[model samples]
Structures are given as structure tokens and as C-alpha cells.
Target: MPEVVVITGGSRGIGRATALRFARRKGIRLALVARDETALAAAADACRARGAEVLTVSADLAAPDGPERAADAVVARFGRIDVWVASASVFSYGSVLDTPDEIVDRVIQTNLTGHMRAARAVLPHFHARGGGTLVFVGSLFSQIPGPYVAPYVAAKHGLLGFTRALRQEMLGHRGIHVRIVLPASIDTPIYERAANVTGRTPFPLPPVVSADRVARAVVRAARGGRAEVAVGAAQLVTRPLRFLAPRVFDRFIWTLQRTLGLRHRPAADTTGAVLAPMHDPGAVSGGWSRVPLRHPRSRRR
Candidate 1:
């Protein structure tokens, strides 16, 4: 029997790339879940052409019963789920006081609670089967702090703790594993689609890693690997900086976010993909690699 994989947020980004990678291997079946139907269809078709059985579920993971329904649908089609990837998350930018309540709630609901719901939906099956692998696609923000993205950072921190707890709980099951991949500034469409009310346009920082690279990490975790895998070389340095020199880390990260993360270019206040899906959900890569990273100075300055 082929291995069954259920991936959330499969419409684009790391999830889509992971699906394609798994499709390349023999004896694998994929079920892609996300809100964008058109993009999901495109991703599913691509995976099918790669010769892997594919099932696309167009559902929002933030919804109350969305994960449960998706899990049911996957089991109905694939019989069993061997791997579950929790990558369905939304992004937003603004200080806590500056961002609206609903936006923050949505980000937490989708990024943190959404993953929790997925665990609830799948753990029972894993327990029954005596084994399964659960991978959570987190961010470097899970440990290090950055300015203007407090809500996202908070959600990731919570996600990391939750994953740790799950891993501890699954210790008894020999075949069960809980893994988390923390990538720093991946070139995903998240920056373009994220809700921004800070007036300044946001962009991924220097050395933006490719989404496929992050996907490969996820693939390794699913197969068998370390419990925690942090992508990007900078992640290694940042982790220690947080402990060795807390003040220096704070000032350095804040300066970098101000100078490199957000552009001085003014952006009108409009919720981008916060309350709903993106208008044009682009492909896996956000093309940030082509654009050189520079200190975006204001014309007035």
C-alpha cells in the first residue's frame, strides 16, 4: 500500500513544493488542502502529472470544523494518513495597538489554533494505527524577536511550545514523531498577500531562502530526522545572540526590520488576504531572489 500524506495550506508556498517533492517518490499519495480552489487545482494537477495520486480539498483551516472535515475527506479517499503537515497560516503586519482585534485574532486562529485543530483531527488516527509523523512549518520568529510583527511572532512562539508538548506526549509511540521546521524569511507570496496597515510596504529580508529549500526540510522530517530543524544559516547565529547579548539582539533585529524588512514606499491601508484569500495567489517562489536586498531609504531622507 502507498503512503498517504495530508498537507494543509497546499495552495502555494512550502506546502505546494513539498507535495511536488513527495510526488516524485514512488508509493506516495497526496491530499492538498487550502482555501484557493483554482490554485489548489493547479497544484494538484502538477502533482498528478508527476505520477502521484492527488486529492485537493478547498477548505479554510481557520474554520472551526475545517481540519476535521478535511481529515475525514482524506481518510475517505486514502484509507489512512501516514504524514500530516500543518502549514496553513496567514500573515499580518502592525503593532498590537495599531492592528485591529479581528486581524490579530485571525492570525492566531489560523497559525496557532489551526495547527491545534489539525492535531486533534489526526492524532486519534495515529494512535489507532500506532504511528504517524506530524510536521509544523514554523518561523525563526518562534525564538528570536522582530518588530512590527508581534502577532505573528507570538503565534509562532505558541506553536513551538505546542509542538514540543506534542513531541513529549508521543514519546511512548515508537513510530510516532512530531517535527517542526523554522525557516527565516522564505521567498513565499506571504509578504505580498499579508495584511499591512503600517503605511510602509513590507518585504522579505536579505538572503531570502527559497520555499523549495524549506520544503525539502519538511520532507526530511516526514521521512525521519531531528525533532527540530531550523532553516537559514542566520537562524543558528540569532538563537545564541538572543541568550549571549539580549540587548544587542533586540537593537540589531529592530534595526534590520526597520531598514531592510519594511520599505519607505507608502502603502494604502487595505487588508491583504487577512479576512479572505489572496486575489492572485502566485506560484511557490515570490521572486525575491531576483531583487537585490538593499537599505530602502526614503526620498525625503
Candidate 2:
């Protein structure tokens, strides 16, 4: 029997790449969940081509019930889930003062609460089955903290905390594992969208890691039961700096923001990038404005 893996936010960016990586593994069944039906179908098709059983579900993780529904669908199709990866997250760039309340809510819901929902939804099954692997796609910001992306920073930190607590709870249980993958910036649309909103350049993190790099880490953790992995040397440095010299690091961040003119500015809608505030309806463009997106069919193949 093939091992079943359920992944959220599998339409694009790291999620899509991760799905493809897993597809190459022999005897792995993959279920990809995303809001874009078109993109989900495409991702599923690509995975299917690799000889894996693939299922695609169009779901908005930001919604309260979406994660449960996605989980149910995965379980229904696969009978059992051997792995769960919470890869769905959104970012809003700007100062804490400039970001709208709704955007904050959405970021929290999608990045933090949504992840919790998935964990809770599948944990019982994992526990009943005597073991499972839960992988979280955390960010470097979780440890280092980034200015002008306060929401993302907060959500990542929350995710780290959640992962730790979950791991502790699952400890001593045979066959159940929880771990996190922290990576520095990769060349992805998420960065472009964030840069577009924040009016900042997406530059290479010192020893920046690629999405594929993170995907490999995920694969190793899933197969070998590693507890946690950080993908970049940049993260290796900043993770400690954030703890030992938080104030100093924060000051440096503020200086960078000031030097870069990255203070809250309205994003231009022309870039096809999403902004914060209204997260559920979907991606938003321009400053202080949110564009609601209806769940679309899978668009990535």
C-alpha cells in the first residue's frame, strides 16, 4: 500500500514544489488542497504523472471549516493519512500601524489558526493509527523577525510555538512525529507579492535556500523522522540573533526599513499581487485595499 500524504496550499510556490518532490517517491499517495481549483488540478495531474495516486481539493484554508473539510476529503479518499503538511500561509507587508485589522485577522487565521485546525483535524486519526508525521512550513521570520512584515513575523512565531507544543504532546507516542522546516527567502511568487506590497526588494538572504531545498528537508524529515530542520545559513545566524540581541536586531531592522523607505505605502494594483486585511475573499492589490478571490479551479500543472 502507498503512503498517503496530505498537503495544504499545494497550488503554487513552495507547496507546489513540495508536492512534485513527494510525487517522485515510490508508493506515495498525495492529496493537494488549495483555493484555486485550476491550480490544484494541475498540481494533482503533475503528481499523477509521477505514478502516485493524486487528489486535488479546492479549499480556502482561511475559512473556519475548510481545513476540516479538506482533511475529511483526504481521509475519505486515502483511508489513512501517513503524513500531513501544513503549507498554506499568506503574508501582508507593512508597519504594524498601517496594516488593517482585517488583514491581521486573515494572516493569523491562515498562517496560525488554519494550521492548528489541520493538526487537530488529523491528530485523532494519527493517534489512533499509532503514528504519523506532521510537518510545518515555518519561515525564517519566525526566529529572526522581519520589519514591515509584522503580521508574517507574528504568525510564524506562533507557528513555531504551536509546533513545539504539538511535538511535546506527541512525544513518547510511537509512529507519531511533528517537526518544522524553517527556510530563508526563496525565489517564489510569495516574495514578489510581499515585496510588491511593502515596496521593498526581495534580495538574497545570506546563503538563501530554495523552495526545493526546503522540500528535500521535508522529505528527509518525513522519511527519517527528523525533529526539526532549518534550511539556510542566514536562518542559522538570525535565529540566535533574535534571541540574544532582540532589541539590537529590531533596531537594525527599523534602520533598514527607514533606509529602504519601506514604511507603510499603498501597494500598486498593477502587479497582480495580493495585500493584507481581507484574506478570505482572496488576494488583494494596492494599499489598504483587499481583493477577494473566489476559489478558482487548479491553474498550475
Candidate 3:
């Protein structure tokens, strides 16, 4: 039987690349899910051109039933799901104090709750088959605290806890596989979306890896059954910085925010078009893009 794989946020960036890569592999079926119908169809078309079975599900994973609907749609079409990849995420960058309650809530509900819901929806099917792999497309922000994007950082950090707890619960469980892939920065539309929230440009992390690189890593994790993998040096450095100087790191982040003129904009609500102090996505291609380099928004000079 061809392996059936479900990928959220499959319209663009790493998710799209992963779906495309898997579609090219023989004996692999794909279900692509995202909120954008147009992007999802485009992604599905690309995957279909590769001679792989492809289904596109347009659903908001942040809504209560969005995850369930996406999972059910995939299972209904493919019959069985061999892999579930949670890649759909909303990016925001702003001070917790200034960010609206709605933004904060939405971020958690989408990034964390959506994953939980998707996993729950698929676990039964996975167990029924006696085995399956769960791949989490988490960010390096999950490991370290970022200054301006407090809500996003918090959600990512919470995901790490969720990942670890779930790992402990599922380890050695009959044929179940769970893993996390942390990527520092990849060139994607996510940067632009994040800019809307944080008013920042999306740049590579001084040496940004391509979305293809992260996609390849996802494929490798799915094949090798690795517990966790980090895709870039930005994560490599940030992980240790958290442990080495916790207070200093926080202070550094504070100083950077102060120095970069990046702070919560004076706005009553962040729901609509509110011009907030923003920074670039920070070297998403790992400093390889044409965008001019700027000081870190979360780090001091």
C-alpha cells in the first residue's frame, strides 16, 4: 500500500516543500492542509504533477473543529495515514503587554491547540494500523525566549513541553513514532504574516537554510525515526544561550528591543491594520538573502 501522509500548512514554505518532496517519492500519498484555498490548490497541483496522489483540504486549524476536519478529510480520502506533520503555524512578534488578547489567544489556539487536536484525531487511526509517525514542525523559538514576540515565543516553548511530555507517554508504545524538527529560519510567507503582527521584516538567521533543506530533514526524520533534529546554526547557538546566561539573555533581549526601536506600538487593538513597531524576520535564509542586515531585534549591540 502507498504510504499516506498528512501535512498542515502545506501551501507554502517547508510544508509545501515537504509535500512536494514526498509526492515525488514512489508509493507515497499526500494530503495538504492550509487555510488558503488558492495556495492549497496550487500546492496540490504541483504535487499531482509529480505523479503522486494529492488532496488539498482548506480549513482553519485554529478553529475548534478545523484540525479534526482536516484529519478526517485526509483519512477519508487516503484510507490510512502513515505520517502526520503539524506544520501550520501563525507567527506574531510583539510585546505581551501591547499585543491584544485576541492575538495571544489565537496564537495559542492555532499553534498549540491545533496540534493537540490533530494528534488526537490521528492517534486512534495510527494505533489501529499498529504504527505511525508524528512530526512536529516547531521553531527554535521553542527553546529560547524571544523578546518582542513574547506570545509566539511562549507558544513555541509550550510546544517543546508538549513534545517532551508526549514523547515520554508514547516512547516504546507499540509501533508509535514521535519526533520534533526545529528549524531556525526558512524563507517562507510566514515571515510576511509575522511582519503583520510584529511589524518586522523576515530575514535569514545569518545563514538561513532553504525550505528544501528543512523539508529534507523532515523526510529523513520520517524515514529514520529520529526523536528530534535542529536544522540550522541559529538554533544551535540560541539553545545554549538560554542555559548559559538566563538573566543575561533576557537582559540582552530587552536591550536589543530598546536599541532597535522595536517595541509595542501605541494601538488600542491589534486586530485590524494597526501600525506597530516591526523588525525584519532576521536572516531567514541564514544571512544569504538580498535583504540588508540589521541588528537583532531581540539582542543588544
Candidate 4:
């Protein structure tokens, strides 16, 4: 039997890259879930070109029944699901006070609650099979929350807590594996799709890594069943610094937020793609590679 994997938010970004990565292995089956039907079909076609079977399900993960439905669709097409990647998320860019309540609620619903629902929907099948892997695509913000993205930060933090609790709960289920992949700023379409109230275009912080880097980490965790893996040099460096020199790290983060995270150009306060499906179904890269990298101090200057 081929290994069957279900990836939420698999239409683009890290999820899309991860799908392509898995497709490299012959005979693997992929079930991709996301809101855009056209995008999902396109992703499935790409995976099919890689010698893997693909199933695309168009569903809004934010809806209460959405995750369950996606899970059901996967099980129907493929007898067993060996891996479940919770990568569906929405980005919100604004201070807590400035962001609308609806945007905040949507972020929590899609990022946190949706994953929880996905876990619930898959755990039974995993237990029945006697073993399976759960991979959660989190962010470095889960540790050191960034400024101007209050809702996104909150959702990621909640997701980390939820992953920890789930890991503990699955302790006795010998074969069940729960893993979390935290990546630093990567080149993804999330910035373009984010709800921005920050008065300027949102972009990933310095030293932006490729989405393929994060995708590789996700695949490695699935194969190895690692408890948690943080991708990117920036993410790995900040982890220890945040623990050793708390005050210094706090100051550094604040400086980066004030200088590099936000821009002064005027931007219409639209909700971006959070509330609706994107018409374009963007490619893997967000064109961040063209943006010159700048350090915190340089940004301040």
C-alpha cells in the first residue's frame, strides 16, 4: 500500500512545496485540501506529473465541518491516511487595537481551531491503523511574537500550545507521532494575502528563506517522527537568545518590528484574502528574494 498523506492549505506556499516534495517518492498518494477549487486542481495536476496519485478537495478550513469533510474525502479516495499536515492558516497584519474583530476571529478560526478539528478527524483512523504522523506547520512567531501581526501571533501561540497538549495525549498511542515545524520568515504568498491594517505593504522579515526549505523540514519530520523541528538559521539563533538574554532579545525584537516589519507607504485597509478565496492561486515564491536583506540596525538607520 502506498503512503497516503493529507495536506491542508496544500494549494500554495509551504503546503504546496511539501506536496511536491512528497510526490518525488514513487507510489505515494496525496490529498490536498484548500478553499480554491481551481488552485487545488492545479496543485493536484502538478503532483500527478511527479508520479504520485493526487486528490484535491476544495473546502474552507475555517468552517466547523470543513476539516472533517476533507478528512472524509481523503479516506474515501485512499483507504488509509499515513500523514496529516496541518498547514492551513491566514495572516493578519495590524496591532490588536487596529485590527477588526472579524479578522481576528477568522485568524483564530482558520489557524488554530481548524487544525484542532483536523487532528480530531484523523486521530481515530490513525489509532485504528496503529500508527500515523501529524505535522503542524507553525511559525517562529510562536516563540517570539512579532509586532503589527497581533492576531497571527496569537493564533500561532495557541497552535503551539495545542500541539504540545496533543503530543502528550498521544503518548500511550505508541505508533502515533505528533510533530511541529516552526520556520522563520519564508518566501510565501501569505504576505500578499494577509489582512493589512499596518498602513503599508507587509513583507517577510530579513534573511527570508525559500518555501522549499520549510517543505523539506516537514517531509523529514514525517519520515523521522521528530517531536519538533525549527527551520532556518534565524529561528534557531533566536531560540537560545530568547532564553539566555531575555531583556536584550526583547529589545532587539522590538527594534526589528518598529524598523523592518512595517512601512510608511499608505495601503488601503482591506481584509486582503483572509475572508475570501484568492482568484490567482499564487505560485510558491512571494518574490521576497528580490527585496534586499537588511539587518535590524540598518533598518533603523
Off by over 4 Å in 3: 195-205, 255-301
lDDT (C-alpha, whole model) for all candidates: 0.87, 0.72, 0.73, 0.87
Q: Quick one: how many clashes does candidate 4 have?
A: 0
Q: Which candidate has the top score in lDDT?
A: 1
Candidate 1 lDDT, 95-183, residue by residue in tens: 77899988998899999998999999999888888889999999999988788899899999999999999999888888888999999
Per-candidate TM equals 0.95, 0.83, 0.85, 0.94
Per residue, candidate 3 scores C-alpha lDDT tens digits across 66-152 of 888988898889888899998887766566676777777878877888898888888888888899988998888888777767777
TM-score of candidate 4 to 2 decimals: 0.94
Q: Write the per-residue lDDT of candidate 4 for residues 1-301, one digit (tens) a residue.
A: 7999999999989999999999999899999999988778888888999999999998988999999899899998898899999999889888888999999999999999999999999999998989999999999988876677878889899999999999999999999999999988888888878898878756677779899999999999999857888887787678788899988888888787766666564577889889998766556777675564532323444
Give the Å shift of residue 131 in candidate 4: 1.3
Instruction: Score residue 225 of candidate 1 by CA lDDT.
Output: 78
- For candidate 3, the 10 contiguous residues with the lowest summed lDDT are 273-282
What digit string (tens of lDDT, one per residue) describes model 2 on residues 1-301?
7899998988776787788899998988999988777667777887899988898888777888988899899889889889998888776666687666777777888889899989999998898888889999998877766766788789999999999998898877878889898877654446444423454433223343456777888888788756778786666566677688888877876775555424233345222223322223222111110111111121121
Better of 2 and 4 by TM-score: 4
- Ten contiguous residues with the weakest lDDT in model 4: 292-301
